[model samples]
Target: MQNAKPLPSYLVHRYHGWKATTWTENRAWYRRLADEGQRPRAMVISCCDSRVHVTSIFGADQGEFFIHRNIANLVPPYNPDGEYHGTSAAVEYAVTTLKVAHVIIVGHSLCGGVKGCHDMCTGHAPALEEKSSFVGRWMDILRPGYERVKDLPETERLRALEKEAVLVSLENLMTFPFVRSAVEGGEMTLHGLWNDIGEGGLEQYDPTTHKFVPI
Candidate 1:
């Protein structure tokens, strides 16, 4: 507790500004949302990258989206070993409780996590190869994705691996029984998206064509 501290001065100032403007203007809506709880239509699984603003990209208001951000925007294969599974828990809650109609996995260009996986798989990042590195272990979820794109030209491999992360997550998500049931029952849909941050371009995976087309 001794190390705990109040919000930083800059963040505090920003919060005050937002509270005076946005919060005050939407007080009634905020109150109603607090009273009724959230009923977001979609669950967005995206990377923890600070630049990837999911809500801003979609023009979503508060309570309109259930977003879960993690390294490389990954979803591991379902394993109920009584361990802590933040992403999986979020998925279960959104699917079973919130009953979101769609689950969207968003991957992005220049993802550090994806790069780490690439480096680790290629034996370029020795520190990440250590057993004690949390990020290294986490990025292991995308190892298979790296393998799929490792042979491509160095220039195109990163982008390809980035998209592959989305595909891997989409595939891993279906390994969950509840997700599979929901999709099979026509109660839910799954989507994979890749964002080109610099170009402000978005591409969506097309299952039929087996490609990502710009959107």
Candidate 2:
């Protein structure tokens, strides 16, 4: 096996800076979290985008949110196959064990994952169709979302499908028995969010309006 590499000089400097500031400032709270274990009240499923800061966006403190970031922030339909299901496992742990009161699917504008799905489905990215593309396979979850927006103007479909990613995830979350039970029994709630990367605007999905409204 290869040995782990050392941190880059710039990252090491940043780490030291944080350790002297934010970390030292919250040393006790951090220790308390480690001692008592995390009890986050919400679980956030978001994209793996560098600009999407889940915690900073909510002004949340440590242990405030249990976040799971994936490509396009999707949740697959419930499957009980004894295979590696990273997203599903996180959801199970968050809902059943953590007993989080809320599960939020947060999508964002100009998501490369969403773009990849768009390119892949539209015959633009042939490499994604191969069995070897992890991203392509993972993005397959958004295929249905892509279909829903296919009829729209090609120019407008990507943005529409980005929101659809959040909607699709909300629907898939219900496929899990525990999630469905908790949501239906009023013990837990589900939410969908779409964030504008450049504008910094946040929108919450409104089932009644069937649209994303400004938050």
Question: Quick one: best lDDT, which candidate?
Answer: 1
C-alpha lDDT of residue 67 in model 2:
96
**How big is the positional error of residue 133 in model 1, measured in Å on the Cα after superposition?**
0.9
| Deviation from native of the Cα of residue 203 in model 1, angstroms | 0.6
Q: Give the CA lDDT, 0 to 100, for residue 96 in model 1.
A: 98
Candidates' TM-scores? 0.98, 0.98
Clashes of each: 0, 0
Model 2 ranges off by over 4 Å: none
Give the per-residue lDDT of model 1 (tens digit) for 165-204. 9999999999999999999999999999999999999999
lDDT of 2: 0.96
